[model samples]
Target: MTASTLSAHHVGITVNDLEELLAFYRDVLGLTVVDRFAVGGDAFADAVGVEEGRAEFAHLEAGGIRIELVEYDPEARGSPAAGLNQPGATHVGLAVDDLEAFYADLPESVSTISEPRTTESGTSILFLRDPESNLIEVLES
Candidate 1:
């Protein structure tokens, strides 16, 4: 028997600084800003399961997926690393057409934990830490 697999729609991440995030994801990494909305209005709050208030968010499209960058009023802090040995919280993997050029374009904002290298699978990949300390995988497939 065959069953359908779940498809990921979008991933929402809370950010304290929208400007920094936008610069990293949009300017540095080159994700397209598809849309944006200010969090307010009871309808919008209810829909997203949050209390009504003046929050702000940006919808970014990267590699055919949606990334919601939210700045909630009374902003929330990002999670601490799960553990040094374990993979840090959630990571978003991005496919780069040109790994070298991409690495060259990265701003000082994102720290390169490891430089670009080839995996056993012959995949060229690298790890980066975002401003919020979230791990990001840049791979060439």
Candidate 2:
């Protein structure tokens, strides 16, 4: 296998609140909802290693990148841990045309890690948590 032969399919994020997270990604971030669906049954349970796997899901696309948001059944769900230093913790980085406008447009309820800052390389980046507390990094393209 080679890197050239591989391409990104999508980033899967597990959320507790489907509607809230969907609103943030779709309405707030302006990502287009490509598709929405629900999954369940014995097959899904076996694949996910859950006794009875079931969930609602949505796929949003932005700049050719797809974000798969999943809201698992409450009975089969676990709480999210905090901190980026933890193992297996993942954050999605997105490139935006206007960093300032993007930051300003974010709702006040959105918890930002800090104000947008430019690095020595001249790339502007900011960090914020989604409705489900998933860390998202927005960078100026």
lDDT of 2 by residue, 19-96 (tens): 999999988888999999999999998998777879899999978989999988845435556678887778998999
lDDT of 1 by residue, 19-117 (tens): 888778887778999988885788877776666545788989987899888888755555767433576457778898888888887776678877899
Q: What's the C-alpha lDDT at position 67 in model 1?
A: 88
Model 1 alpha-carbon miss at residue 123, Å: 1.8
Can you list the residue pairs that collide in candidate 2? none
Cα-based lDDT at residue 77, candidate 1: 52
Among these predictions, the greatest lDDT belongs to: 2
Q: Which runs in model 2 stand beyond 4 Å of their true positions? A: 1-5, 74-80
Query: If candidate 2 were superposed on the true structure by all CA atoms, what would the RMSD be?
Result: 2.3
TM-score of each: 0.78, 0.89
Tell me, by TM-score, which candidate is best: 2
RMSD of each: 3.5, 2.3
lDDT of 2 at 38: 95
The runs of at least 3 residues in candidate 1 whose Cα sits more than 4 Å from the true structure, single-residue gaps closed, are: 1-6, 41-54, 82-88
